[model samples]
Target: MERKRDYMTVQELTENEKYKFWYFKIKECKESGLSVKDFCDKNNIKPSTYYNYQQKIRNILC
Candidate 1:
């Protein structure tokens, strides 16, 4: 039997989808009233990785 998957792999996502996913994550972090370190820790994200995505999103927007 084939195993079921619950998450999409990065390789399976389009560029737009990847951007939107990270974009919403960054926005959610900002609106959560928590520090970057706290948010990342709570969400199981690496703070550096989150900052990188935030930078990428800002570059895209600006």
Candidate 2:
């Protein structure tokens, strides 16, 4: 029998972790005075993905 490797798959992140990750990125962008595009580019994240996360945070707060 072969053992399965779940570690190779994508791991689910907790809500707190998600919040902290996005919050840090958002804060970094603000402090760096970089446009969203530049920040996402420098960070190797897609702008659309970053925007979606940003919108989700705003929606939850409202």
Number of the top-ranking candidate, with lDDT as the measure: 1
* Least well predicted 10-residue stretch by lDDT in candidate 1: 7-16
For each candidate, what is the lDDT? 0.92, 0.82
Model 1: pairs clashing at backbone N, Cα or C within 3 Å: none
Stretches off by above 4 angstroms in model 1 are 1-13
Model 2's lDDT to the true fold? 0.82
What is candidate 1's CA lDDT for residue 31?
Answer: 98
Error of 1 at 10 (Å): 11
lDDT of 1: 0.92
Question: Residue 61, candidate 2: how far off, in angstroms?
Answer: 2.1
Name model 2 segments beyond 4 Å from true. Answer: 1-13
lDDT (10s digit) by residue, model 2, range 5-41: 6554333446757877897787788899889999999
